[model samples]
Target: MRNIKMTIEYDGSRYLGWQKLGDSDKTIQGKIENILSEMTKTTSDIIGSGRTDAGTHARGQIANFKTTSNMELIAMRDHLNTYLPRDIVVKKLEEVPERFHARYNATGKQYSYYVWNTPVPSAFERTYSYHHPEQLDVTKMNEACKILTGTHDFIGFSSLKKTKKSTVRTIKEITIHKEGDLLHFTFIGDGFLYKMIRIIMGTLLEIGIGKMSPEHIDTLFESGIRSDAGMTVPAQGLFLDEVFY
Candidate 1:
């Protein structure tokens, strides 16, 4: 058997996230597995690096699966692309060591949230970016970002109410950049909980709009209270930038 690693990109506007659910649902993993099973004539499971929520896009998502077929890498890539949907594409495929597990071996992940901070509605970017009519103070947002750097208990940013374990995670970097009317918030982290990035973005946005003080950001780390965090931004604005091993 050989393990194949695939780098995938998808526009999540039409699908129900990355994982496969029931037969009634259409998912990114389900689509890939359907095509692979047909090509190999066997049961195949495609494991993803991480699960993106519905309507969340991916630019460099990674996945791996074991196969017994003796097909060449080029042929397998062509075969899968012929069967996969247009919204989802496999950018590259390669054989990897059997010991490499996509999810468990992932060292870190990078995500970006985009916002069109303007009054004009963008016809092309509406689906991919969030539109904010109010002007945001980018400087204040950057100041609040400092509070998010380093390791901290992030229970305040997570939405999982029933989670009993600690939400401690390390954020390696948080960058806020603006060019023209577009604003991008990039986060690099060892791991993240449900809706953590969106919540962090929301909190920073509040600071940008002068609704929340930058000094208040430290309360999230000290208290670990969900109420101390900001609202959860829409998932449509978030993108899984890449997964690194």
Candidate 2:
């Protein structure tokens, strides 16, 4: 058997997110696994670096599967692209060491969120950006970003109800920058909890609008109160930008 590492890019507009669900066939993992199983004549379970919420997009999502087939990497990639939906594409594939588990081997990940800051909503970007008409103070948002960076227990910012797993994760960087009518928020982290990035983005937006102060971030860290953090922003604005090993 050979371990195949693959990089995938997807629009994610119509899929039910990355994980394969028992009740649904409209998932990224399900689609790829179905194609691979049919091609290889055996069950092919692919492991993703992490799961993206439904309606979210990905530019560099990494995954891998072990297969008994001896098909060439290029041919396998071409075959996957041809059979999978147009929204999902296999960007690259290569053989990796046997122990290279996609999820467990991942060291870090980068996620990006986009906001339409202008008064007029964008027709083309409607599915890709969150539309916020209110004027945002970019400088104030950056101040909040500074507070968000570094290591901390981020339970308050995630949608996870409860888990024994550690919610404490290191956020290496958080940056908010404006490009014309758009506000781009980038987050690099060792790991993130469910809906953590969206919740953090919502908090930053609240800070930008003067609805919350940057100092309030400290309170959330100390209190770990989910209700005190911020709203869970819509999933469409979020993107899995990259995965690092």
Candidate 3:
């Protein structure tokens, strides 16, 4: 048997999400599993590094699958691309140690959100970014990002009400960059709770538009109230950029 690690990239515009859904055949995981199952002639359970919400994209999503077949990595990758939808592709494939687990062994991840900060509509960026026609103060957004970059119990920033897992997670850093009418927000973290990144982005956006003050970030931290944080931004603008081990 061999343990194979694969990196994937997908548009995620038409798919339901990364996880396999009993409700739909248009899922990233389901598409890949079907191809792998045929190639191995056995059950092929692929473990993803993490899950992305519906309509969310991934540039370097990672997964690992254990297979008894002796298929070469290059042939397997080419075969997967041939059968899978054009929107999804296998970027890299290789053999890894047996002990490597995609989800459990992941040490950190980087998520990015894109915003089209212009009054003019962009046909090209309609599906890839959030279009905000109103003016935004980029400086204020960075101020809010600075306050959010640290270890904290982020229950206030998540959509989940209850869980046995800890909501306390460390955000190693956050970097915001703007060029012309485009804004990019990058987050590097140990881990994120459910909908945590979207919530944070929404709050920062409110700050950028003068709807919320930067000081409100501290209030949310102290209060731990989900409603007090911000809205849950659309999943379309979010991307799982990279996963680190």
Across residues 84-175, which tens digit of lDDT does each residue of candidate 1 receive?
Answer: 98889999999999988899999999999999899997888898888888999988888888878889888888887857687889999999
lDDT of 3 at 13: 95
Q: Model 3: what TM-score?
A: 0.98
If the candidates were sorted by their TM-score against the true structure, best first, what order would they fall in?
Answer: 2, 3, 1
**Clash list (residue pairs), candidate 1:** none
For all predicted structures, in order, the TM-scores are: 0.97, 0.98, 0.98
The models' CA-based lDDT, in order, is 0.89, 0.93, 0.92
Candidate 2 lDDT over residue span 122-178, tens digit each? 998899999999999988888888888899999999988888989999999988778
Model 3, span 194-237: residue lDDT tens: 89999998999899989999999999999999989878888888
Clashes of each: 0, 0, 0
Model 2, runs deviating above 4 Å: none
Worst 10 residues of 2 by lDDT: 139-148
